[model samples]
Target: MRTAIVGSVLLVAGAVAAVTGILPLSDLVELWDRVWPILLFVLAITVVTELAAAAGLFTVIAQHTARWGRGRAWTLWLLVALLATVSTIFLSLDTTAVLLTPVVVVLARHSGLDPLPFALTTVWLANTGSLLLPVSNLTNLLAQHAMGQPSPFEFAALMAAPAVVAIVVPLAVIFVLYRRSLLARYRTGEGVAVDDPVLFRWSAGVVAALVPLLVSGLPVWIPAVAAALVLGAVFLVRRRGVLRVGLLPWQLIVLASGLFLFIEALHAVGLGTVLAAVSGEGESPLALLRLAVTGMVGANAIDNLPAYLALEPSAESPLRLAALLIGVNAGPLITPWASLATLLWHQRLTSMGVEIRWGRYMLLGVVVAPLTVVLSTLALAAFA
Candidate 1:
């Protein structure tokens, strides 16, 4: 619903800008043509992730996670963090935010465990863990393309170290914060029931195939679309009745495309020039730090997509651009309004019977998010 409103607003605003001769229709068309792959990749990867989840893949993983924890809270936490981080990096943060959060929530409760640590792990990782892949976050896709299209491997190469630092810092932070709560664990008897073992195996196999294919540096959409089709075929053969049209990530696709159009419109009136000024020819560590701080604050203030769009034009080089990306990916954790993933995670948690104190969430984020943004950007500045 919000995506529709935002898309509609962008359409109207862009139309007005074009009519007033502030922007050319040709420019708009060119902009859309340049970034259209965002929609395709988002849809294809989302489909693949959703289909695999529907095939009971996530549930099976969650159950196995419980078994592996051996009634140890810290062990369960490490596993949960790993799961959320993996889901975020591979499937995009939204998949982890929307799909994995619920699974972890239920797993925590079913295992008679405190849920806050698990829940926080999911949401935190959903934001910070998205740095490692082109497909990991829509922001990364936009940043990757905006900076000039790099291959999948090249994109990951730049982020590989920062991504590690991003996850590691948060792991240490969360461990400190929740160490006491994490000490209790409950036995998950046997395992969560898996409904069709063969279908599960097939769906899991297709998902596993995605890692190599994406890292192959081929176009992400092609491999993602192929995987979705393969898993989708298995689902249809066995679980045909469960497929819903809503499984298509139309909102996300529209969100990505609409954000582009809106940002381009902003560029038409000289806003982009102002933003581009921030990127000057400074490549010093301090310059990177300042730029990242700007991005981090922008994301918390107006959300990361627009924030990235605003900051992107100023990123004078790939290195500084990569630095800005660290802020964009890791810095959005400070508020509910910071990223759509945080919002979605909040909504999911509330709906599933967890009462999140907004005040407290923000307070904790204030303490941790800036720290995360600084550490992550520093890692990028040093290693990337």
Candidate 2:
């Protein structure tokens, strides 16, 4: 497969680079200074959040809504999406997906609705809403910290228009596609009982974990430490039973952090400068459109986080960063590997016996991705 060939080529290239001393141990050491702490923090938060989520906290909330009426299916979907969005505000996308995927799968099976729409909506909302906080997305956080810019809240205010478009348009599409199924599931009786004790304990843990983010000017370590303490307490109380609760997917966290460092490597190696030269300095509509298209294409080929990080060093203005993020996020809707969130959706759907082919997903992506990027870019330019 093409993926295999590309992976092989990258491996060989990396080996050669290391042997030739093109990327020296010294260079790697310097890169670690810039990357390792962020990677560790992201991984830690991801693990703790996943543990809390798997404790059946959100599932319990979904079950309560399912008891209300059939319409609660949509409400349940919205709640998952909202939590996913909120989670991305403090945790990375990998963390959000790992934390929410299991809960979404169980809720969909219980409600008799396909999990695809719910999972996809959650992923999309996570990408959009995370743009609200500096710590929301790794790429955003890196850019802000690197540039010594203000907090993410300030950037979020500037990006409000695109954020609204990103959240609203896809939701409309999801509702239209699944309206009948949603209605049918709502009419069916509520499926199962939930464990109240586990739910309350997890809810308390989530609150305690989030306390650090609520107070401004707190060190990022505060939330990281709180999450660890809360999860440790929960595990102690649950004892051996805690192992039954899912842990975060450490592989995804590793992949995300590795890609972030790799892209930062690319930037250090002057790829961004080369890209800037090729892009030229212009603010014309055609130039902006070209940049957006290029961003989307790069994202599909490599992953949004890496694409954003690689582009960060070359971006000449805030508008460029905004455009790149919008386009990169939009393009990932097309491919399974494009975004970990989409991959998470696919995994959840598979677990529930729903298989969506790449071709079918592409059908949706072809229609929505371009429109979303174009609209998002225009909104960013107009507002920023």
Candidate 3:
């Protein structure tokens, strides 16, 4: 809680500094000019996705799997994670959190499993899965636009090997550690009970909202506009009472936009050029590896999106970009603050009274993240 407060304070202070000229508005304006469309697009998608989740799509999915106990719970959670990943591929990690976290919390309680693992899996895989598509994560989208890199399908194919390794290995580790509890829960026949018809209706509505986004290659704005209309109609039908369904995290949306503007200010001060120069002197695979490692470490210190924005312009090759992206996503596994998804997961866990200490989370990250990074980098270097 203290960490969240401090982080919030820092975010606000940074935004103030940027706006007041202490951080330089010229750079902020330059980036805003160039990236504002994408920013709006992301924000719109975030809003719409949140609304869809409020409609209870995850609850509906979880209910269908309630009969199988632990296996059912784990599988459902895994599917939720995958759905979050898919959502992130199109919307962004933030949107995935908005859409999935509430459902995950309910499902975790219903299944009698620790929410931490599910939360971690969602955030971690959301990062990895988003890497497979250009629209999946902010960093990937920026990289694609800035560099004219591979298409989403192309990138996903290239990342297929790493994605398998990442998901399978982590699940194995998680299962090994928690097998007893999982098995016990399975034997007990514990499962989620469907209590609310309203939730089911909402879930159906959310799925309806997402179909256009998924089936067609329509611009994000189309989905955004559709969601707004649908949500608005739902609101009018319920006479503003339905707003409680929680379609969006308005605070987070504002916070992300503000941070982006703040980082843009830093970028304008020639930080990109400085970093680019540092990156240009060497092409050693080890050096590239080190950069990726450092990026992960730095993401914990700062945040991943900002760190990516700062480092991305310096990336000289597709290989370097891949390393940086994989490293940044993997790095967040080590620290709660390393990725927005982690932070959101932490918040969700704490809200549910699930206690996972920072030390333990870091311990897991130290073990898993480096291995994932190395494997992902090798895949990228080989294929990209």
Candidate 4:
């Protein structure tokens, strides 16, 4: 409800800007051309994941992951990390934060392990691991369009170096910080119950197939829409009660839409020049570092999405763009509002009676986020 109200306010502000000539109608058309497909992909993918959750797909995976741990706490944490990484890489960070967090938290509790490490892994990996693919983050999708709609393989290749680094750094930090708890053993939990066996199998199959299709380079939305439609039909036939208007992710769509318009308006009014002045120029290591640091600061100060949009004009080349992505994607670990995924992860944890100390989270992030961003940006430069 708070998110919906925020979205409504932003949407109204964007509409007012357009009406008052703060944002030209001509640019509005161009923005729509670029963003409509991205919005559609978000809508479709959200529906797909929501229905899949309703069918118990992620719960089954968490159960299997816990069983695979065989009573070793470290192994279980690693498995959860792997699960969060894969979920973020394929399903988007929001999905990992929103859907996978609760499942893993419960998995850890059921197995008699502290849930903090597992919870931290999901939120951190959701941001860091999201550097891998276009479908992995909304920022990646925007960057894909900016980079001429590169094939998924091509995009992955460009990001491969930093993606590995972004994932490894926080993981290293988490391991060191939580070694005491992580190294301890836990009991193996029983299998999770599924209310409907047939629905679970079908949803699992659909998601399994959807993963490859997402990276098939078929304009993204096509595969996502098809998956959503299939899942919607399945739910309608098997359990119509789960199919509702709430599945559409209207709040997110509105928020993103307003962000697009407002950011574009800011750019039109010379936000680009100001950002470029601060971000500097060239692809030298120092120059890239400046832009990346600028993005990191902006992301932590505001939110990553707007920060990325505000600084994008300064990222004139592929390397600089990569640097900016490193900052905004891997560097948003410090604040609750730095990324929506972080907030969503917190909400899930709070709902599940998992308490997280924000002060501790911020302190750890202060150490981790910069280290990850700097190391990852250097990796990007080296790859370039």
Candidate 5:
């Protein structure tokens, strides 16, 4: 609701700016031209995941994962980390945040383990693990556009090194911070019963098929929309009551639209120049670090998407662009609003009765964000 209100205000402000010529009409059109496909992908993929969850697909997987853990908390934690990574890389960070957070939290509780470790793993990996593919993060989509539409494999290869570092660094920090919790053993719970077995089977099948198509070098929205429509039709037949306006992710669409316009308006007024000056110039390791740090600061201050847009012009070289990606995609771990995924993850956790103290979260993030960003950036400079 708060997000909707803020998005409404920003959307109105951007409209006013365009009407008054504070932001050029041509520029607005150009921005939409670039972003519409990305937004479409976001909406479609979100719907697909939401419908899948509603069909008990994620719960089934979580229970299976619990069984696979063999009663070791550490093993279960690692499995959840792997699941979160796979979800973030293939489905997008928002999917991991919105869908996987609850699954892992519930999985932890059902196993009689501390939910905090599993909860933190999902949210952290949702941001950091998102660096591997264009579909993993919205900023990655924008970067892919800037990079002339590289093949999904090509994009993944370029980011593979840093993406590994980003995932590992967070996992290492998590293991150390929650070593006691993770080292304990727990009893495996029984599998969750599917209320609609046919719906679950179809939804699971659609998701399995959709995952490969997402990375098949086609525009991502094609597969996402197809999967969403397939699941929508299944739900309509098997569980019409679950199909509602709420599944559309209207707030996110509105928020992203408003953000793109609002940020473009700021850029039109010379935010770009200021950001470029701050980000500096060069593909040197130090220069890349500077740009990455600048992006990290901007992301923590505002949000990752806006930070990426603000600093993108300065990242002309491929290496520098990788660095910027490292910062914006892997660096937004501190504040709740640092990335939309974090916000969504927090919301999911709260709804499931998990309470996280913001001060401790911030303190932990302050330590982990810099380490992850710096190590990941250096890994890019060294490897990519």
Candidate 6:
């Protein structure tokens, strides 16, 4: 994973530089000038989640969730699903993918339940559940900046109903798909043993503060940077020895740089006109559907973040731009390479010795992503 991220960063940087004569400086400059706060918000959330994970916060929550299941697989499924959704919304889907996936897998295995449904629930929710907040998915931030929305809260106002639709559609579908397997519950033995109760509470408390911050209509970076700093200080006082530069997420920084550079190069070569051609510029249902389908397929083929960046310039209307992000954010379920969250979910499953067949995966995704996009787009259309 690290290798791929680094390699992509290097390749995009080298290729764009080779072609553009100075590494897409104009695009980078423009991106930094316009959207640097989004980058900081992304990085801060990454750091905050990583730090919280390091403090064993996610593990504690996972175990408690399993315990809350009380030996009922269905309840366990609901709780785990809720946890995954919450993690994706608050900590970012990357955290849900990288941290929450393994925890749920462990919980399922410990309870002698089939891990597939729980795992799928986590992975699917990681992408689909991220529509609620601007910081929930990087694409949300991109949508905010690229669409030039006047108020950050506008994303929530317009997307809240669609976010609900995005989450509920998959929840219903996946439950039916996994219901047979979820029968016959077993108790998760003693749940997880948390090491530091004080730090755990502190971590959870500070992290919870992010909710109010995000909805406060303040800048996206303010609450996140504040929360991350508080947690970093806690770690410094309690476990200062464990502090390392690794938590800074340099790879993500590089990835951001490469994405901007790549987009810059594309713009330089006039890809915007092509993207604009496909972007639905009207308020009609057909135009909205086109935007949703196109965004989903493009995201699955090329990854959502870059796909959003590539096509974002073409989205002129508020409703169209929001719909585009809905597709990219909620509809990346078809392929493993569709979203970073899905990719991270795949890596987590593979490490846990679970493999999902491509056919079955695509089959489910084909059903889920479209309905998610359609219902959510309709909701957005109504809201808009």
Each model's lDDT comes to 0.78, 0.63, 0.62, 0.83, 0.86, 0.76
Candidate 4 per-residue lDDT, tens place, 168-224, comes to 998999999999999998777667789999889888898788777766667778888
Model 6 misplaced regions, further than 4 Å:
1-6, 9-15, 22-24, 33-55, 86-92, 95-99, 132-135, 141-157, 196-257, 344-363, 379-384
Estimate the TM-score of every prediction: 0.81, 0.79, 0.78, 0.86, 0.90, 0.77
**Model 2 Cα displacement at 340 (Å)?**
4.0
Using alpha carbons, what is the TM-score of model 6? 0.77
Best by lDDT: 5
Candidate 5 residue-wise lDDT, 276-364, digit = tens? 99999998789889999999998987789888988989999667888999999888888877887887677667656899997889999
* Residue-level lDDT tens digits of model 6 in 147-250: 67556577778778888898899989988987886766786676556577767777889877776676566876898899889998988898886678766655
Model 5: residues >4 Å from true position, as ranges? 144-158, 350-353, 357-360
Residue pairs in candidate 3 whose N, alpha carbon or C atoms collide under 3 angstroms: 50-247, 51-247, 55-202, 55-203, 89-136
Count of clashes, each model: 1, 1, 5, 0, 0, 0
* Alpha-carbon RMSD, each predicted model: 3.7, 4.2, 4.1, 3.0, 2.4, 4.1
Error of 1 at 46 (Å): 3.3
Q: Who is ahead in lDDT, 1 or 5? A: 5
Per residue, candidate 2 scores C-alpha lDDT tens digits across 55-148 of 6665665565556544566777677667776666666565566566666666676677777787767766655555555666656666666556
Query: RMSD in angstroms, candidate 6?
Result: 4.1
List clashing residue pairs in candidate 2. Answer: 70-186
Worst 10 residues of 4 by lDDT: 247-256
Q: What tens-digit string does per-residue lDDT give for candidate 1 at 58-163?
A: 6777777788888998998888898888878877786678667767877787678888878988998999899988878878887787768998899988888889
Q: What is the lDDT of residue 161 in candidate 1?
A: 85
Lowest-sum lDDT 10-residue window in model 1: 251-260
Report the Cα lDDT for candidate 2.
0.63
Rate residue 259 of model 1 by lDDT.
Answer: 58
